[model samples]
Target: MLSKKIKKLLNRQVNAEFYASNIYLQMCAWAEAEGLDGAAEFFRGHSLEEREHMDKIFNYMAECGAPVTIEEIPKPPSEYDNLMEVLKAAFKHEKKVTAMIKQIAKTAFEKEDYTTFNFIEWFIAEQHEEEVLFGKVLGKAEMLGFTGEPGQTLHIMDSYLKRLAAAH
Candidate 1:
């Protein structure tokens, strides 16, 4: 059973995750409009993954006998200056997610909710992978230089997105 406070927090997280999905979807749209098809596809896929993450928590809440309440998701930003700017924003967002997950884990530990803590372990691992993946992309963008040929950048991003899509 989850404590009432924890249950509320988890439900809030569910909404936050939904917001994340929407945010990524908006970014994907912006990428497509900017002619970065690979980035668009990548963000589109990521939005799906975010929905899965939200569902995971929602399911957990239900299984634990807690009521899951979903709130409205806020609108996400629709425009970005360039691919690099969008990617940097993505990296920052992932970092924020990692921090949020850690805070949840800390709370679970403090409350002696071993089951919840264990459950959150999966998210911790997931966030680590997310961070690493975004970090690698950021590193590549840096190497390629933000001012590089847009076509070359798109090709490279397409290759990476293909790999990620295949992995999924």
Candidate 2:
């Protein structure tokens, strides 16, 4: 059986994951509108990944016999000033998620809820990879100069992102 507090935390995390999916999808749309198809595809794939993340938690809660409460998905930012801003936002969101996971893990451990803590280990590792990936993207965007329309840097980045998307 799960504690009431952990149940609340997991439910909140579920909502956050859903919001992340929308965030990535919204960013994908913005990238497409800016003529960055590769980036858009990358974000599209990322959005699906977020949904999977949510499902993992939802299923885990169900298995634990805890009521999984899902909240309404919040609207994410639909526009960005530039590619840099978009990348930064992605990293920021991921970082926020990492913090949330860490805090919850701490609570889980304090409660001696090893099952919940063990389940969250995957999220902890995933968040590390996400942060590193997004950080690299931000660095690449800065190197390519993200202010204007399509350029050489964007072309290269598009190809790279396309490959990255294809890998998953």
Evaluated at residue 39, the lDDT of candidate 1 is: 76
lDDT of 1: 0.83
Best by lDDT: 2
lDDT of 1 at 156: 81
Q: Could you list the CA RMSD of all candidates, in the order they appear?
A: 1.7, 1.5
Off by over 4 Å in 2: 145-149
Residues 105-138 of candidate 1: C-alpha lDDT, one tens digit per residue: 8989999999999998999999999999988887
Off by over 4 Å in 1: 147-151
Q: Identify the candidate with maximal TM-score.
A: 2
**Residue pairs in candidate 2 whose N, alpha carbon or C atoms collide under 3 angstroms:** none
Tens digits of per-residue lDDT for model 2, 123-163:
99999999988888777767777553557776887877888
Q: TM-score for candidate 1, please give it.
A: 0.92
